[model samples]
Target: MENQFSLAHLTVIDSPPPEMTYLAARAGYDFVSFRPIYMGLPGESNYNLAQNKQMFKDTKSAMKETGMKLLDIELAKIYDGVDPKSYEPAFEVAAELGARHVLSSIWTDDRNYGIERFAEICELAKPFGLTVDLEFVPIASVVDLAGAMDVLRTAKQENSGLMIDVHHFHRSGDKAEDLLNVPRDWFNYLHLCDAPVEIPSSKEEMTRILREERSYLGEGGIDVAGVVDRIPNVPYSIELPNIKKTQELGYEEFARRCLQTAKDYLNRQVKT
Candidate 1:
């Protein structure tokens, strides 16, 4: 089987690295998603692409130390209501790092033109041979599997499709069979996380800890194994937003735990 493990940048939000690369590598993650200017960084939450020309290079170096690869660079503002043009730098960085994909979200309300506009951006990436996958987030547009598929169909591009996030499955009230029905080819990545259905808080409450209060594999209420079963074999990543524990346990331990949890889940899945 293809070993597809992804390390999400969200877990290292407070690490003291001038960049996010080292934390990923130290935790034994294969690939990770990075943000040129992450979402909730000080004042520039929206359209937070900084002028740090070396951010990409620094991040690349971080990967070198840890033997980790960059899977995608994030587009955080796209979810917070920033113009799509702001995402160009992230795409540029992903290309520069020799990454294969770029991930972002399109709010449900933006369906008017979000997907179409995304298709237009695909042209820019083809030159670099990168495929873009829009993450189906519950709080963002494309809340459910069907809605996300609509965007993919509208784009009609081989490179664009849905990135099934486990949390969103519960948020959108979708089941495992609903996920299995997805055209297998349309899936590019799997974002793994499990949380309770307690109306998961929004960024309005606290930016960093959204997925943190979650439990490990089979510990939470989410049907994570069932969700994983539906995706076939694809690149898997974790966004364990541990609210309080990360402050105590630190990023490296957090990354290790997340990876171990994922391994446990995948092993059980293989047995199943």
Candidate 2:
């Protein structure tokens, strides 16, 4: 099967949607993921493509010019009291753009409430032909593959699934063998990045590593190849967010290097 690689918006968070699409295409990525909903965190950049008519049109034009597909749009955080219905506009834009997935996470401590809300969001997203992918991060309520599976099992929504980010999988103490227990169909796509083998000393450091210090595939100690080998065939979203590298090389060159390195790493994995 041909590998489908996507330029995750987080990889170039500072770039607008139009530039992201153009750069992804120029860098030889097969698809691009967008972040239409802000993560609601301080210092985070977001774009409201659904409401920005001109930006939306420009992004569409860039995709047309580059022949790049829309892989997904993020992010929907299922926190307590945050209405999933409020995300309808973002879903509308994703559907109009033919995106395949929505990256989401739960922030509440109550597992039951989180599951219910996630299910509701899945139902809401069904009509838009979008899969709601619940990403498991160490800082979030659903912190591991098993926790994410618990929600997926209870929600029982066909349109809901798990989205594994390699950094989170490693930091959460999840093993490559653990992936064997998951149903293959439960995975829609995955986020790929690399990090140092040493675990962070504190939550603050971990957060910094995840958001700003990740390395390209094969550049750090993460067993990206091992994890990739275990997962079923699915598109990969290159999500390395190295602020320093981006500063030195610029977004365009940084993106190109990311794609090339990922392709090279995967090719070596196949050969081995």
Candidate 3:
């Protein structure tokens, strides 16, 4: 089977979308995830391909030249006061770029409201052939796999599912066996990265750890092998972002190392 390993935009957020695509392709990634919407606060690197015609053209050209596909576009936060319909323009851009999924998360405590907004977003995305993958992170309102399932079930959207980011899965105190309870079809794709066995003392520390200090496959304390074994036949987004390492080695070298390390880890898992 072909391994669909995608390079997440967060791994190289410093590069523009077009440059990121080219770097990911050159580094042997099959697909690249783009962050058209910035999930963080203001002053973050948010690319508006819908408005920037030239950047959009360059991104499309890069993908065509490198034969790399657009795996997903991200950061669709479902929160109170945010109009889900406003994201239709972003969805349109994702559809035009041939992205198969849109990554999103819940930011509000109101489960009923969260479900309604998520469903609305799914409804908006469905016509474009995009699946809404709800990624549960520690800092988000839906903070675990179970919470993500709760939202997905309540939303009842045909084109919606859970996105298992392995780091968040482990850090959130979830077990590998928990995957057994999740419907196989509920999983659309996954993000892979390793982290220390020791949990961070606080949410801020954990957020900082995940955003800037994640380790490559097999280089940290996470049970990467066990997690890989549990989830079968799904595309993986290598979301490890180590700012220090990237600064030392540069994006190209860092991207190459991440791909090779992950490939080695997965290959060993298959043989075992």
Number of the top lDDT candidate: 2
- Over 124-158, each residue of candidate 1 has an lDDT whose tens digit, in order, gives 56666778777776656677788878878878887
Any idea what lDDT model 1 has? 0.68
lDDT (CA) for every model shown?
A: 0.68, 0.90, 0.88
Greater lDDT among 1 and 3 belongs to 3
lDDT of 3 by residue, 142-231 (tens): 999889988888888999988988899888888988888887888778898888989898999999989999999988898877777777
- For candidate 1, give the lDDT of residue 125: 62
Between prediction 2 and prediction 3, the one with superior lDDT is: 2
Displacement of residue 87 (Cα, Å) in model 3 is: 1.2
Pairwise TM-score winner, candidates 1 and 2: 2
RMSDs, each prediction? 3.2, 1.2, 1.3
TM-score, predicted candidate 2 vs. hidden true structure: 0.97
Model 3 segments more than 4 A misplaced: 40-43, 270-272
lDDT of 2 at 65: 86
- Local error of candidate 2 at 203, Å? 0.4
